[model samples]
Target: MGFRNLQTFLFFLLLMLLGLSAPLSAAEGKRLALVVGNSAYTATTPLANAAADARAFAAFLKENGFEVDSLINVDRAGFARGLSTFSKKIGPADTALFYFAGHGMQLKGENFLLGLDAELLSEFDVDAEAIALNSITGIMERKASLSLLFVDACRNNPIADRLNASVEGVTRGAALKWGWRR
Candidate 1:
């Protein structure tokens, strides 16, 4: 399917999943969402529709009874701060949802979502600048009964070429796990 169509499908799928999940916590719970879109990248190719997708998804979530926290073109500091703020808001009874549309990568068996101002000069810089997929998942896993993480990122990007470079001991079969939908 086309990119826009895929995004639409994913949004509807989230809505349906949330709808189904709502009744499970109907007795006592709140729906919370953190929607992030990183379109302007300094180290990689810029995306055409990530910001728009985030905005639309945030709107849909807000209309569907979620207390939404939306962000666009976030830098590394902003990204970290946003997560920290969102995590503090999550409660045991909250169904937390995280949605991200941007560039992402995986190295050394760890997945990462790139920030708007991320400068991936070397693989080592990833840990310092990018958001780890597991970190996001871990935060939600701690507090929420039901947590959903949706990431719309490039699967095969030119940035992946760095892994292929004969840089001493860097592994060859590194799988770039971009999307984090759970």
Candidate 2:
């Protein structure tokens, strides 16, 4: 499918997963969203569409009554700060949503979302340089009544390939073992 089509599908799928047939109303409790896009990467080739897509998506969410926190071309520390602030806003009755558009890779079954300043020289750097996907989900699962995560980061990752190549017992295909599934 086309990129726009895929995004629409994912948005509808997310709403369906949350048992929502239409845009949420004010009576449904608070709606919070953290939207991030990292395009200006220093270590890897920059993405052309990520930041723009995030801005558009954030606007859409705002129109639908979501209080949005949007960040673009952010570094690791910036990402952490955004998440920390977002987590603070979430409440037990809130519906929390996270959307990320950038580079992402799976290493040893764990998914890591890359920031603009991420430099993955080895697998060891993942924890320090990248944001763990589960960390975002864990926050939402803990503080929100309903949580939705939409990751629009799928591209050829030369950094991951290099890391896999450098590590012993790590195969080229090992990164593909995990996928988004319910």
Candidate 3:
């Protein structure tokens, strides 16, 4: 390929890598959202409320005439893909929102949202499955006059454990035991 061809290729490649997509609006503005629910846990209890919360919020967004995209029961890979897809769907002057429900924890001076099946025997294993909140937020901050974020993953232990002994199988996770539910 000639130098000019190479330059053009690189330019388009850069845009694709950056998750840039068609602008949401050429006239009337539109809204987009990334709704995530991480409720899979291996070590501790799984959050039963995450699924419900995600569904409810997505419904609300749709009712408000926003294009609500979602990835429920997402692990790390799913989360990353969701973010990428969402970024491409939003643009400057457009509105976007993100809603999360599941388990969230603070580790190594960073915040991590745990998947329902997250098994964090130690902190070192966190980043693999849990992504930084900023990774999701920074996308919305790119020219969105109105960016909204609803984080419901703050429910107690920030980490869910399968149903607790205290609940006698009535409830299926320690996360809800700690009043961590919608």
Best by TM-score: 2
**Pairs in steric clash, model 2:** none
Task: List the candidate 2 regions with Cα displacement exceeding 4 Å.
Answer: 14-27, 168-182
Mind giving the per-residue lDDT tens digits that candidate 2 earns over 24-89?
656666889999998899998789889998998898788666899999999999999999999999
Predicted candidate 1 versus true structure: per-residue lDDT over 59-174, tens digit per residue? 87777778999889999899999999999999988889999988877676767787888776577776887888888988998899788878787665556557437333333233
Q: Judged by TM-score relative to the true structure, which candidate is superior, 1 or 2?
A: 2
Runs of candidate 1 with Cα error greater than 4 angstroms are 2-8, 20-27, 166-182
TM-score of each: 0.82, 0.84, 0.67
Between candidates 2 and 3, the one scoring higher on TM-score is: 2
By TM-score, rank the candidates, best first: 2, 1, 3
Whole-model lDDT, model 3: 0.62
lDDT of 2: 0.81
Judging by lDDT, tell me the better candidate of 1 and 3.
Answer: 1
Question: With candidate 2 superimposed using the best TM-score fit, by how many Å does residue 133's alpha carbon deviate from the native?
Answer: 0.7
Q: Report the Cα lDDT for residue 137, model 1.
A: 87
